[model samples]
Target: MGHQQNALHVKDLNVAVKTPKGMLPLVQNLHLELKPGKILGLAGESGSGKTVTCMALLQLLNPKTMSVKGSIQLHGRELTDLNQKKMRSVLGRDIGFIMQNPMNAFTPVYTIGNQFVETIRSHTVLTKKQAVDLAITSMEKMNLPEPSKLMKKYPFQLSGGMLQRVMIAISMCLRPSVVIADEPTTALDVTNQLQVLRELDRLRTECGTSILLISHDLGVISELADDVAVMRNGRIIETADVFQLFDHPKQEYTKQLLQARPALLLNDQLKRRVI
Candidate 1:
């Protein structure tokens, strides 16, 4: 219904990949939730199953090799067992994805506009003109420079930051109720990162979009997360309100993450070194 009741719920989730060695378990008890208009930061080290957990949430895992077992419910709808046809409808219409590598999400052969247009046509019966207008609106919402110029360019033609913005534009253009972002700022510099984060904050506030933001950057989580889940060795060790997770971390792993954050308030020695 709201933040009080989970918008998305995961219960006793376990995931494994069949590899040459054996069935390598990746995630366990990986419970998480995303409430409407809230940012739920999912953080972990490399290979901690942060990415895999998100994939499992929507039943997007490659069933050929990866095996997942869990209960994932969005707005009380169980997704794991949804048939292929049904899941596709639910995915783009109600769920959106912003991948860690934006380039990987787009084709180098097509202009940004082409892909956006196609995506809308696939989901809803909107005219090409209508879809383009929606695409432009989404681009403007991300505060991209010269949105028209961006639409003309191919994914390879744009810089990483610009491409990442384009990816966000395309994903949100459909106005999905839920958006799962995997390191949306991975390729950005500090200035661009801050800009994107600000726009993302606006989206959460303006659209009431429930966000599952996955990142290894604790600083990003500290800035935007309403709630957080910390992962280690394929399992979540801490789940708490954003402030509590950062300020009063319960687990040793979480404490270590806080300590490793670069000291923002420079000491005399550190300042002298910088100067």
Candidate 2:
């Protein structure tokens, strides 16, 4: 895709953690590009460096213990060399992140409303009332019940699904250009998973935010991604448009992954004929 159409681009990304013996690479020479208003599914096994790659892309990894190399460009602007202060400005404002666990995104001590207000204020010059309004509006968009009421509760008070939805609301509230959702549905049950996925889909449709959706479940990837990449042993084995990747995967690892998810494969088969 052309530079203007791409929301985020990666080239030769490498991430390694320090070990007593030597540097242990977790992600190697990874390349990915997400187009504006498109969803890119990044699928891999549990330890396949999917999360590591996401963290690296966002510059979230600790420099002291982990090392990252290569280019991460968000809208054609290089992010690898930015200082912490500048990166912080870019992080939530330009690039939103929806972590796997909602609690990881919020503080235990603060009320949900407090956190949301702070997040909104940090990026925009909106007043507290305006920020609260935006928060409630975002919650309403997610079909969250009684947005005002949920705001008073702590992170621990809400159910896992509710927390997930709340985090989604917060992440998308800023209207960031790109969103990196790491294992967003992993902790939710089937019902909540569908709800969360729907919210993500709505974000892309309504706001035109490009998404990098990382997940171990091929089923979830199949449901949301426009394009898909299969990763293993710190490398992407194959990538293609969603239907092509599911129906005629190029790599053995990708094939095995699809075979293991029999239900998803059946679903994809049905989808293929419809297309």
Candidate 3:
């Protein structure tokens, strides 16, 4: 889609960190676009600048130590120009972020309900009771059992899987236009991974929320992403439709990545045989 039609657009993006020597590039000349209600998967090996790209898009990196230069437009609104205060307003409301570790996403001292209600209240002018009700409702939609109970529990009390779902619920409660999910399912078990993936799929299909899904797992990307981009050494080596990239990778690096995951190929074969 064109820039005007995109839910999130990034062009000529570059990120660098200051070192004793000088500025060192971590991501360079990157371009990405997320269409409304679609998932774009970013796949790469660890240290390939995938997470750095996400941080730049969210404007979360420290400016004193890092530099992010680019045009990041969310629904045609330029985000790079916005001040920190303004960016805070846009973050959870306009763009939701799901981190790799759910535990790190929440405050250990606070109950889930406290954090959820506070987040909702901060973004919207809802009273505590109203926010509580909304949080329960959103948790229910995520298929969490005993939504009210879950809310009352502390983040440390819940399992990683449940906590991830709670995080997803919180992110989706506002129905942000775009969600930047950075390795969202990486820390979960098989069943929980599937559950998390299902919830993300439901968000795009039901809520019409666009997602930029960053993951090292090709299997996850193949399962959930509509389009895929391959990053290596601070640059995008290839990008194509999910099927096209998987079946016919153009770059040697992409080919090696696919080959490195023999189990993914085996799993695909097993499913096909069962079908």
TM-score of each: 0.92, 0.94, 0.95
In model 2, which runs have C-alpha deviations exceeding 4 angstroms? 262-275
Ranking by TM-score: 3, 2, 1
Worst 10 residues of 3 by lDDT: 266-275
What's the C-alpha lDDT at position 70 in model 1? Answer: 82
Q: What is candidate 1's lDDT per residue for 63-175, written digit by digit as tens?
A: 99999998898888899879989999888789988888888989889899899889888999999999988888889888887877777888888888888888888888888
Question: Against the true structure, candidate 2 has what lDDT?
Answer: 0.90
Worst ten in a row by lDDT for model 2: 266-275
Clashes of each: 0, 0, 0
Q: What is the C-alpha RMSD of each candidate to the true structure, in Å?
A: 4.5, 2.7, 2.4
Model 3, span 6-46: residue lDDT tens = 99989999999999999999999999988888999999999
Alpha-carbon runs more than 4 Å astray in model 1: 1-4, 263-275
Ranking by lDDT: 3, 2, 1
Model 2, 187: alpha-carbon shift in Å? 0.5
Clashing pairs for model 3 are none
Top of the candidates by lDDT: 3
